[model samples]
Target: MDVKIDSEGAFGSAIVTLEAGEKFVSEAGAMHRASPNMDINVESRRKKMKVYGVHLSLSESNVCR
Candidate 1:
């Protein structure tokens, strides 16, 4: 799924393109409006068997600031 957070850095809209054989059974949403500093929750169909590093992909707004 591709989601773009709003310009206000609050809520976001997403274009979920699931894998052909995969399905999104359920989802939980909250904080329709929130700032950039808000905590973000992430999920995946599979569990992490080992610790992985995080990659930073900052947008122009957040990066340039």
Candidate 2:
């Protein structure tokens, strides 16, 4: 999960570049601290069929919310 973000800041002066995996881990940690119920599951996909269901749930949440 390599992450690269390109965006102008409020002042539009500084450029920020962050690794996606690093950001997700950092955010997941903070979110976990604030709300103890959301379990951030980081799993390497072993099979397509096995992960399809999990991916569907995550995708649905992304759109429905």
Candidate 3:
């Protein structure tokens, strides 16, 4: 797999190229576009998280392709 990140000012985007049988994983809602030949799957999980001394329950989504 090959990845590139492009940014201008405060905005940025990632471009990824994947070979056969290769997969990419990323946080859900992070992908704006993908090639038509690629297959995409989404998985969600609930877990406990803590930040800044605060406890939180979060549902996380992962995208795999």
Greater-lDDT candidate between 2 and 3: 3
Error at 46, model 2, angstroms: 34
lDDT tens digits by residue: candidate 3, 1-65: 67787654555787877666666766555677765666666655445742122111111232233
* Candidate 2 residue-wise lDDT, 21-46, digit = tens: 22233321122121222334554454
* C-alpha positional error of residue 25 in candidate 3 after TM-score superposition, expressed in Å: 0.8
Per-model lDDT: 0.35, 0.30, 0.55
Task: Return the top candidate by TM-score.
Answer: 3
RMSD of each: 14.8, 12.3, 9.9
In the range 1-65, model 1's lDDT, one tens digit per residue, is 34544444444454333222323332434323333522333443444664333222323344223
Best by lDDT: 3
TM-score, candidate 2, is 0.17
Question: Using Cα atoms with residue i matched to residue i, what is each candidate's TM-score against the true structure?
Answer: 0.24, 0.17, 0.61
Ranking by lDDT: 3, 1, 2
Which residues of candidate 3, in runs, are more than 4 Å off? Answer: 50-65
Where model 2 places Cα greater than 4 Å from the true spot, the runs are 11-23, 27-65
- Candidate 2 local Cα displacement, residue 20, angstroms: 14
In angstroms, give how far residue 54 of model 2 lies from its true place. Answer: 20
